[model samples]
Target: MFRDEGYDNDTLEDEEEAIMSSAIPSKVDPLDFVYTNIPDTTHILKLDANCKHCKAKKIVSETDGFCCRNGQIELKQPEPIPELMRLWSSMDADSRHFRENIRFFNG
Candidate 1:
């Protein structure tokens, strides 16, 4: 009876591990705060914002405009809304619910 109980516990643990391993991992988009695209013609701005890449001050000056304080940071374009929504929908219900509750400044 003890051996049977041990075997059952082992089976349950294996099943739990398999379920966790097969579950889809949650994804995080770094550019969730960006609401609008920065126009190609508007490279330099007087506004104060953090660089999406390095989390440093975004702009310097009009004459010596730089993306970051060190002028080495580069921004990445966000995934298209439809593609992001598709991925979001594919996630497990619990993950989707958790992500849906997250609030971003832009929206």
Candidate 2:
């Protein structure tokens, strides 16, 4: 059992490493390479409010989701509507009800 668990752990770690490596470009200076190869464009280190991805600019939120420079697709987070509905259904009437239901509230 212990040996089997160790083997499974090793497999998981290997898979994680493979995924992470694939996510990032293999170049020593990925940014430098991009700047040299690709056309002049804005450089973003992280996706935040100012970032186009977070602001849902350039790409439609309901459609394209996020944009990537190298044509690499950005995966969308799972929609919360269904999960919220499930939670609402499971909850009692009092617990589910909200006093002040604020809609379209953005930080």
Candidate 3:
């Protein structure tokens, strides 16, 4: 998106006045890390942990009852998605990709 210097004269703006300067520091308010509108984060974490445990328990119960008949059963704990997975999940393959993946959108 390079601008053509022929049509757009940058000299005009420079001749008028300089805009805001970030170099001169001003006392701006710091960000509020403690959000008020959102629910308790600790409670949310606990709920998420409990939900995962419940799902695993349910899977094990079903597997033990149905599949593990020969007494040779190995319950494999699913490998957790690492931090890098966020990049692929959030940026590379976004909501549009997910919507298509889950059949929420027409192919």
Which candidate achieves the best TM-score against the true structure?
2
Q: Across residues 26-102, which tens digit of lDDT does each residue of candidate 3 receive? A: 66435545454676555322222112332332332244334444335556878866743563366455644764565
Better of 1 and 3 by TM-score: 1
Give all candidates' CA lDDT scores: 0.60, 0.54, 0.46
Q: Name the runs in model 1 displaced over 4 angstroms.
A: 1-7, 26-42, 45-107
lDDT (C-alpha) at residue 25 in model 1? 50
Candidates ranked by TM-score, best first? 2, 1, 3
Query: Model 3: how far is 22 from its true place, Å?
Result: 89
Backbone clashes counted, model 1: 0
- Model 2: per-residue Cα lDDT over 23-69, one tens digit each: 99776774775577665678655433433444444522333433454
How displaced is residue 60 in candidate 2, in Å?
Answer: 54
Name the top lDDT candidate: 1
Better of 1 and 2 by TM-score: 2
Q: Against the hidden true structure, what lDDT does model 3 obtain?
A: 0.46
- Over 4 Å off in model 2, which ranges? 1-7, 28-107
